[model samples]
Target: MEEPQGFFSTGDGCVGDTVTERCLVESKEPVSHVQLACGLCFCAFPLDGNELCVWSTKDPSYQPLILRGHRQPITAVTFGNTVSPLLICSASQDYVMLWSLDECRQKVLLASPLLSLLVDEKSKQLVAGCADGQLWVFSLVERHHYRCVTRVDLKKKRETFSRRVESRLCSLPEENRRPRAHGLEKGEDMEGSLPVLSLAPCDLSLLLSSECGCLPSESAPCLWVGSSAGLLILNLANFELEGVLRYKDFRSLSIQVAGSCAMMSKAGEQKAICLLTSMFGCQIAVLEIRLAALMRSRQDLGAGRSLSVLPRGCVLSTSPLHFRIAEEHRTPPAPQRRTVQDQPLVFHSKVRSSGYATAPHVTMFSPKTNTRNNGDSPSRRRSSHRWCVTNLHFSYSFYAGDGRWLACGLANHLSLVFRADLTGTPAVFSGHDGAVSTVCWSHDGRWLLSASLDGTPRVWSLRRAELVLCVGRDLFPKPIQSAQFYYLDAFILCSSGPELQLLKCHIDTSKDEIRRYKQKSRCRPVFRLPTAGPTEITSLSAVNDFYSYLVLTAGRDKTVEVFDLNAGRSAAVIAEAHSRPVHQICQNKGSSFTTQQYQVYNLFATTATGDGIKLWDLRTLRCERRFEGHPNHGYPCGIAFSPCGRYVASGAEDRHAYVYELGSSTFSHRLAGHTDTVAGVAFSPSAPQLATTTLDGKLQLFVAE
Candidate 1:
């Protein structure tokens, strides 16, 4: 298998990137580079007969916002700055126009046949390139109205002098108008309008989305204009010419882009601009510019710390470059182009207004006003305490404080399924793209943390019914096998990377625009735990009870690491703690009467090794005993302990839960009900009951007699 760009394979040939398609939008035309913001995607393309069109990203199989208004084929399209609301501007031969996101309406701006479009977030200015060899920068006083800062005619001096052509100045129309013949006929149209060959708007404030800068700076915004004649860079600050680098010797190699240009940001530190020119068939030309020097030149504007600097001196190249599109992307069928005749002033469509409904994917389901079989499958049973709610299977479940809230780990997301006291369906929290590996709830039941193979742990608020924070890969670029809150506050300990990591995190509520409380981040990661190797840490368990301030972790390395907060770092290390990869860990308070004395001990168990659950004394950091009745078929199946610490509970791959009396070290009951491997087992803090989640999506509650 081939690795993606920017990724490297390990000595074992394991690369970090996973190949998966999140969504697909098949169109009858070639799709431009897509930009996404505020849960929406915007793309522009020329459809049947080069009809310029704009489509908003839609849910799978959902009808997209087919925005139409451009009179001629589009040259460039881009979205507004991230801090600003959703605003899309497009430039074409028809003139410059602004399209409101979601609403299907368009407002005509300058009537000049514009070539490119860009919005400077700092000054709130709209900049465009014209086909008549002129540059126009419009200060957006409000909307639709633009007062031009300046305009420059870009016709070369040699061309003007050689032909003795008296260059006529282009007009900036005060009102909306389209060029046509003087004589009016029923079917007459304008064929003189042509697209500006090349235009690209590179914003300076886009660095806000990357967070590489500590502070926001004025992006001394500029436009890179390219034509068959040469390349010219214009300053948007005063609409002045900054520099012009042309290929006088290689004249035949410079036919500019007839469509839009693309940016490759992740492939290299330098922001490389890739454009497909009309001069060569399937040939791509890449231009890499140093924005730091440009920013330093305009440092008065928002320019953060110096970014990357390309060592190259030349800005223009004549060598043919090929940008390979993946094989999965087929060459869009080129439809027959209709003659540019009988052009109408106003473009009509099925849409009357630009208003569009929100995509259906952002849906939420709360508890019911009238309750049913609770959190169980509908066909399972109808008891009050035990209900059948769904046919969908779950891999893990946990009963929060007093057994009021039951959270189950689903596919990439998880569910906060309440007990029978509450109504409605469960609240599903989604973000991760990998299967949820482990889940833990905070002591007060306000915060719920779920770890996944997606290399991050998502923080979900049970009170808000929404996902609050995502501990991203930046904190540690390793799959989070398990994660837990240190207490109710403080930081979090996640089992990832070489061993474990401490992430500085916090959450709080803020007033929204209308003064309603909304959860937001107070801080992010402050530092990371340092380790030596690249081996994966797969399991984590920490004691938050009054019993102790200790943490236990194990994984593929077959070693158990215990971290004592009060004493600092691993208090002890048990070598060869498991024969195989450790899967799960459960920390509980256990009391044993030994030698005519009642002794309370800090104990934890690991579902590792070919043997069953192995119980260890945390105080001594030694294995107390191994319980081996349950079938050890899967990697470290789930293990749990009762709140009172009287009984030890665990689930095996054979779909059986083995409960043993800790004092006797003997099996007490063999619970068999699930159709598949029992992924997790949890005991209620207040009630004498056990909850089990299976791979077949079953959530069952078992009560102790």
Candidate 2:
């Protein structure tokens, strides 16, 4: 038996076809808790309480990786450091389990009566934070038993130190040490005399203890603690209190230090990585504490600095604190440095405000031939101070001829026209009962046409600031989906229900009557335009000459159809126009021209779907190219061609407006800062300025570079 041929096709000849490509621009980084290794691909395992799922960087889909066996929700998971990679540590409530990745077998590493557990690099040590505000460090041995090696008992440790100091002072000779020394316990000597307490048996020499509220650094095992008075650093090696770093009023929640150095292969070398945190947004501090630096500081304390060093061939630096020494006796160490790692992974509980300064707006010039600097000497300048209109709620906006006036259609069924000079009150025209879906002004700037969800189309006289006439339901009795008016002929093409209708308006003062000349419907309402099943009409736009052509309509059926008014028939049908529903379509007047000999006129502009924006040429009914720099996988909500035909600006559901240079087919700049979806984008007819409206009830004006 022969296998059936696949239904999918490739290449350029057919309409309603599909094409796929990898995206080049990246959106916001995905939120994840644990990352997995897969060669060059970085995958994140996202946990939502009980489920364990993995998502890769190359693909958007996520799948379940592990399930069952975990009595409580897994807090964290990490792979082993070795190439053989047998162990995978899973931290859960009160315990951490070491599981063999190949066999899927598990063994309890450290069982602490705590809420959370964290395993160190070797999986030989585990750190657990308990409900009693204490941290427990546990060690595992080959005998299959866990031992508590160190316990940071924060409860009443200060009180116990006070009593011990009092007893020691009483035994001192009266001539050598005065009784007044008892008050010194409240200061410096309090930390130095505290004894190091061992919680369990371990061969390692280091044992550090301090107050409850602090975290350990990556390089040094020195735990930084914050008390009611100031910051304290405890040396983990000898359990001695180190020097204080900083003093502050509020107790520190977290602290990080940063620096930079060349890579080295040997231990006791200087290295640094910049550290940032939620506590301080952009301020970075240098963390300069080499093994040599620690050893020198120890010698300065008269602790006998000549400690036994590790063998030359030893790769792992066992004690991070012992490598530091004074610079005078140093041989500059070896050129080999520890491999620099990525930034430490930390979970911040508080939101941090951005620290980036606002950039001053600058201006440049764009001539017909080439772009050039506008002034005598090109220099950046701050934009003019203007009041931001915060009360306006507009879904879309457009400028009239020469940008003398800006017209915006709001969700409240009001069309407002503001003077470009920003001097007078904006003219308000309200006629529709529902939201105004679309609004546009005539080419001559005499009339404005608006379509609303109220199932009517209204024409407003700009000079009078009043509705002159209403179309749709009064004549066709169907809801007007979209409408556009021609300034020269006073002809209007409106999409009503499933049909495109043409209407001509006339006014007679003597008869005191408004006359409407209705032409035949260009496209018949066949199949109800497939309201469902991927065939609903999404957008409609008109070309330059209304007498020759009436409208262009795009639908979810992946087709663009041109309606011819003169011939009273569908002029051309461009099938398979987009991958998804085309939400917006606009005609480029400058590109829509043909010579007598060529017999080809192309309308160059943009159409949008859920994927991205595509530049289309109407003559061949083919997509010439695509603009692919939207940061999010957003549905394009609005698009417009610059008056000079040099740029195309598009708005998306991602709350950003992207401007693309038409000649070079590259992105010009991104206009962000919108708090909600950008519903519409428009360019000024006179100046190098653009306007956008968002769902957050705000209007923003941008000047081009």
Candidate 3:
């Protein structure tokens, strides 16, 4: 046989295809460095040793490319004026390089060390501190060239003197010009009017030096010097002493002045000098020149008058060399909330229905209505009642007439019946040698049917709580998997090893004997339905009506088969409907009907290998939809549809009961009070309540909103 078009070959035969294909491309390089930036601390790492990798904080695994370079380890990164084009300056200890990165590629420019670096619109400058303690001025000379200019030398001397004394009489004081015996005057106006200082290289007139450690200005005619004893402000234009600032026991390391003093420049402005000890301690001292004194000085020099400096403002001390201040602000506006208005509402019913009527001797309105409403007010009752039954692991359960009684089948071949009247203790009926697999109540509420792994079906009287009859292997000569009562005639569908046998049931109430209503010789095989490859039938449920009479069966084939019960033969099949062998099949209440209007109905639902619940439409013989959000590790063992047809509850091997909404077609929520795999789920007929039993032998009741 040619393989199905979309199916892939597997060890377990053909299955439906659901995976999508994808491809990935990788670069041929190794990653080197990683860094995180921004005020929010987002992570940015290097990929391929050349590309910048960026990823969100929440998801660090998926790294996307932000920028790629031709060379590796783009060092010296800085965020420029714009957030983009984060300026990255890299040097290989041999070549100095500059790169402007936008998003993907790094643009390399200015690959030389002699070039000066320009401060962009971001107001940040790069000052080179050489090993000789000399500062180099770097500014943009052109669009691409940065001119480097060497500024000052601290080793240069201002004046030199010879050690020869000219004359001892010349050191005499001016007040006493007459020479004394020792040739020394008492009051001395000696030291012959301080010697003039001159530059060594006269051609380098632009070069300036200070007596103490002072800063040379680019546009000022005065150089300010600072030493351990005092501060010296000297006129560069006239080579004269201008002003002296005194401080005790402190030395200055750096001086920053506002403007010139000799020339008509912006003077009288606040000048700041940063003082530092040899031990790397710093202090800031400020000097403000009076505007009146500055104006008079300019007038004395025969220069045009102008307000060189504004009035002094508040002076600050001990400011850092590179200081940054940030103002605290409020958080940004929240994003507009997005509402998922069209998402379907999932209605979940608890394991048992609350407000179930507890009246005795109540009758159902009609066989077709399936309504058992009593005159009791729904608000007057507690949602559910708690019961204590030890080791009561139930695999199947049914609620009879007006929710007055409940029957449960257990894996230990024990059956339990709980009276809703809450007046008496529950009764246990045990007879089968193997696990009881199914239980159901007759329409008239007189007989209860139970099928077991012991290959027998038993009938019990509800009032006496006693086993009435046992239909064993002698009747069908095979393992009976499921049995149900249909009004006067009981419909028993059995799995005889691998074949399906349908038998009609009859009860001789006078002798209290139950037997196969049809003669053994006349009873023939109705139809032999297909299994899940080689798996046997595991479960079955019969619909309530005639024409479209359906028998839903689950098998180890991972498929749920819907047989045409009235056709007397299994003709159509839904193959491979589940990912694995299905454990149970259940018909929704009110799903079985014969009507003139052709209404579509989701007849039955099944639970299988995966944590998935599938809905089957009987009329089309197709699997309509699936609910897939259950715990993936669990094996779904039993399923039950709520009487309201709005929700489906399932029990799994993970010891949890999962409730799924039929309208939303999704698993809504999970109930986690069970200690072992939940084996059965049954809802109250009159209200939204549920009863659940687990393999650990605990029974629980739950209410739904």
Whose lDDT is greatest here? 1
TM-score, per-candidate, Cα-based: 0.42, 0.44, 0.42
Badly placed stretches (over 4 Å) of model 1 are: 1-401, 420-424, 514-519, 530-534, 546-549, 566-568, 589-601
What TM-score does prediction 3 earn?
Answer: 0.42
Per-residue lDDT of 1-705 in model 2, one digit per residue for the tens? 011123212344343546453222221334345443342322223244443332224432211134335566666766565323334566668567665442331111122234445554333455554433345555553332454544454433443333434544554578644343332345544322221111111111121111111122212234433332222333332223333322221134234321111111122223222122223344433233333332222222222121111112322233211122234653323323122223322112231211111121222222122324344232222112232221121112223224467777777777777654333456778878977766776655666778887877777777767666676465545556666764233456666555665665542212223533432222212112222233446567764322223357776576677654433456556554555666667765421111111111234454655445666544334344455545323434677876445567777666778776543223445677777777677666545556776766655666544
Off by over 4 Å in 3: 1-400, 420-424, 476-478, 487-489, 511-535, 545-548, 591-602, 632-634, 653-655
Order by TM-score, highest first = 2, 1, 3
lDDT of all predictions: 0.49, 0.45, 0.43
Question: Tens-digit lDDT track for model 3 on 96-196?
Answer: 44544432221111111221122322111123322221223333322214433222222121111010011223433577333332212245222211111
Q: Of the candidates numbered 1 and 3, which has the greater lDDT value?
A: 1
